[model samples]
Target chain A: MKNFVWLLAVSVSLSGCQHPSLAYITNQGDSTVSVIDAAQQTVTHTITVGKAPVGVAVSKELQRIYISNVEGQSISVIDSQTLAVTETLSIQGSPVGVALSPNSQTLYVADWYSDRILAIDTSNTKIQREVIVDKAPAGLVVSPDNKTLYVAARDSNQIVAIDTQSLTIQKRIDVGVHPFGVSLSADGKHLYSVNVYDNSISMIDLKDVEAKTHSIKVGEHPYCAMPNSDNTKLYVSNTQDDTVSVIDLNTRKLISTIKVGMTPEGLDYDARNHQVLVANWGTNDVSVIDARTDKVISTIKTGNQSRAFGQFVMQ
Target chain B: MKKLLTIIALAALSFNAAAHGPSPQKVEKTIVIKAAPAKVWAVVKDFGNMHAWHPAIASTKLEKKGDETFRTLTLKDGGTIYEKLRTADDADMKLRYEIVDGVAPVADYNAFMQVTAGPGAGESTVTWVGRFYRTYKLNPPIPAGQDDETAVKFVTGVYDSGLANMKKVIENSK
Candidate 1:
């Protein structure tokens, strides 16, 4: 009948690509997330989230996406399968950066103004605990084994390591000026911090504690750094330069700079496609980079001010 | 004294002017000029010469410290604004800059001025896109002249006035 045909058309348009690769771009200006189908290179779904969503964390097992809404002061949890917001959990303070444990049991929300990280239990949806950090904690990353959580205390100019079990500070390593984003390798042997003010990246070796951190200069106002699958290369999004600085992890040297859209804020490496998805904040689009050639393959249109600050690609 | 405290607060605001909050507002304005892309880019490429086309900027002072480029703009209405040049890409016909601090009720302002070939023949399009946050950083009881509306209005006004003057200045010239 005519009614059945209309219903079928609506479902097809509403559903996303079933492929494992998709980019959730957090548009703070519009309070929405544009889910880009990486394989098709198009925005398939635009889910409404809380106001001023800045960060994202994806859970592969649970098929969920968590977004930190700074102005809304809450977390918007989206079910990946359905591509819909399942819940909006309120936080006591403003939430900026969000990350999930390797096991997806704990979700860490960084409070930008309050200078603290609150750990929320995903199972029962309880405030499990919290840890106080220094001024302006901007980025969060958990180890592969979920034993350590690293905090980029941006205002303090240092990276603090907290024990995941006890939620206590274990080590505080000083880095260059204004370290905003931190990335850990898959093997958990190396860590990298993006220094927004210094325009460089600090490479820290966890294998050798005595190994002094090496600073590699990058482009202007680099915000996020993401590593490849094998941990051989690192790609950093220079917000002002509209380019990505690709650094060879072995030599600690800048290999090449890949030009992207305006104000590229977040970098996510898609393993299945062997591509890097960059969220362009100024242009409201996502630039797809072919990792092998280091060239922009395609640009998918997103919502206004796309700022997927954390891990946006579903695990 | 209250005066000293106000000065201290202003200094602190300028120092952290590049640090943004979760809520950043953006304004984008574009105008079709009766000129070529090359002619428009030339005026925009001169990072220190903003007063040439902008009617509100009375004069501009250029300075260099170390390897960086900086400029000071004296506004006609009042107050001065300081800016740092991020890049001047001639190949792309683009110029980028950020406001360190200024009279505007904005913080962490970054902008790009791009000149592109037109939607029509023999016409150039100039777009000014700016991203900035309100001067107030903390959770607000919302002070006067420091909210999102004030910051957006100031930038929108600047872009509108400047683009209109730029079209007139470029079209009238040889």
Candidate 2:
């Protein structure tokens, strides 16, 4: 009877530790990452990272998180299980944006100052190669097929697609002025670039590369974009306006603008809860919006200068 | 040869210093007026009549479009500024707006004005705050008028003068 009671107590404790999902937010000012449990809507751990961590990417299959520290000029790798920084890979130039391959075996770091992209082997965390591209690469996205990589070259005002195998530039499509964030539809048929200076989004049809791009006007100083699971809607964070502009993919027009916290920069779509998580830089909090209603449901406080640029939610 | 080398070194250092990217900045100013909080709120919340209280604003024109209110302010120097009213809450005595287009040497400008009861009876405190980035968004060698310092100075001057004049107008009236 005593053994059975101890066993039951252990099982109950272990079950409580299991979290359905986690959202990792990079706090630029504090140089730390706040890990929030989606189920509980609370920050479970705050892991110390390098200086000015702005970009974040997670590999659910591998259970690892990659953070780009722009000022520190390095990438801090965290094991999702341990919720700790396992290693830091130093790269020259200012590393601002990051993405991982579909297989979670390779990592891509965009160096804004160096004007190039560095590919690292994820297993060993070693610099595999570097591909030189346009000026000031700020955002990155991998194709669903995992064959191409799209980069938002801010200064050059273009999106450059690279062949992953060859690690060479495949296509250069002209976009709006100072495009900073890039995203793709769930089917990978359309590509979107958030243009900061023009306060617009450039929608590129991937099926026909030469097709004229459609520019949709959004709020001021838009930083990043995230598409829904079904590609029916797109959400963008306008930093200066402090609002999220909802775009209907069918009409390709602005449907609504939801007010958020100050300096909303990075955003991601959570498939499980069907919510959008936005990192507010000035307010030091995360605003969770209900995708169905397009309204802010809750605001969870994080560290200072939160900018979780890339895909931060662990599926 | 030595003089030429010194000039080259100085130019390189300045260029390097100017190449840093623009960072967001804030400017805030507060004034204590003898008027009551309700009186101060009335003047501040009138989004269309900024020229009446602000010394620098020469004229103001208000327009409404698609459920949004916009105001155009002509400054004393003949420069004009276009702003959109984001929110106005009477209960909180707070008004928020953003610059749509302007000649203020700043980009992505958002401002807030609030009026509250002061330490003394019948006295009110008014505060004006603005957050903005430099007009030049791209990586610098920023131009003379579009640098971070220029943006900060322009916003500071606007807030300082506007609040000072607002206090004078509110206190002197009635």
Candidate 3:
């Protein structure tokens, strides 16, 4: 019995080593996705997709990575382990932002030009339903409980929440102008929207709907945001300013601002590696920020025009 | 809100509509000028007097509204370009600007000019960088004058001529 327990522990750690964290950086200019292994700090594969790949949704359980090709009007599904494009789903409109449900059964795609949200069945690759929301639907995030999917309506200046099960609009929460990137806390207790034009972040309380939403001022022309695992802080990438604003969530104050590459766009928190991977659109590089120190430790050059819009890290 | 709708509708229907592109473009050009860092920066920092150095500009008009400063440049090619001054840091010898609206075949154009000490004595390197998107953003069959190549070529030409003339003007002076 004692030997069996020791063997089980060894096997568990072996599985963990086999599956290192990976970051999928969608390069829009080159129309390819750079799959980087976090442990090695290098790209393992460069999978070519359709034209203008902008968004990424990684599913660890399903072992798949879905990439939205805005100009190609399709989604390229890549096998996470094999690093190969297995299938391509033809979308009707231009797909920009993409998200996966907690259960990984439904993939939500925000069509930027069509102003609609598409719920594609994961197992079959068929779009189960689509609903027209506003002028432009850009960012999307599903709740931890898999009950709600929030989308940022860019031109309408609102965050629209839709019921995942019923596939219906629940609430149109007004946010700052040009809210382009939307994210939810790990615990699903708060929602943050990055207003590109307003240069601010809106934090909405999910536990208490009656609570007043708080708006935190950030740098110029903020693009995307990501929250730490503990929900104690938030990081926003300021595109125009070429910096990242670190916000202390408890006090709702700016903690620090770190300068990065020009036109930093997509950002994702790597919990396993305790790092933040930022895609620099202008410099075509990935700036890796150490979450503990809030400093850029290294920068890995990627394809031309890297904009990993959605959650790209798979732990 | 209604005005925003009107703007969108007009942009969609206009023949040479200025829509956004899927991929962003960048152009960075550098020239080693035989001058001090501060001296070269003085020419770049004089945002209102670009026509003095750049041959493509016929004249420049500077206006200030509240805390914001704007400049209108009348091109020698019989066109005009409006731009806003973002920042001018004397310490770093860097100036940042953005195009408000112009005949340039680009949208959301943001640029910066920086002067740094060069590899040789009594010399400074000037770097001009521009980031923007093509005016026509839709998928295929882009307009002749609004595609990515056209936009990049136009901006490249502008930078080449302006930098060459600025070099000649600065080097020949004194």
Model 2 spans > 4 angstroms off: A1-18, B1-174
Measured by DockQ, the strongest candidate is 1
Each prediction's RMSD over C-alphas, in Å, is 6.5, 7.9, 5.2
TM-score chain B for all models: 0.88, 0.85, 0.88
Residue pairs in collision within model 2: none
lDDT of 2 by residue, A160-258 (tens): 999999999999999999889999998889999999989999999988867758999999889999999999999999987789999999899999999
- lDDT of candidate 3 over A101-167, digit per residue (tens): 9899999998876778999999997657888888678999999999999999988899999998888
Clashing pairs in 1: none
With candidate 1 superimposed using the best TM-score fit, by how many Å does residue A175's alpha carbon deviate from the native?
1.8
Q: Alpha carbon lDDT of residue A176, candidate 3?
A: 94
Best by TM-score: 3
Computed on C-alphas against the true complex, the DockQ of each candidate is 0.33, 0.11, 0.28
Model 2 native-contact share: 0.00
Query: What tens digits encode model 3's per-residue C-alpha lDDT throughout B1-174?
Result: 232222222332222322256566888898889988888999999999999987777899999989999999987655678899999999989999998876667787889999999869999888898988778755555777667776677677777777887888899888
Interface RMSD of each: 2.4, 5.7, 3.1
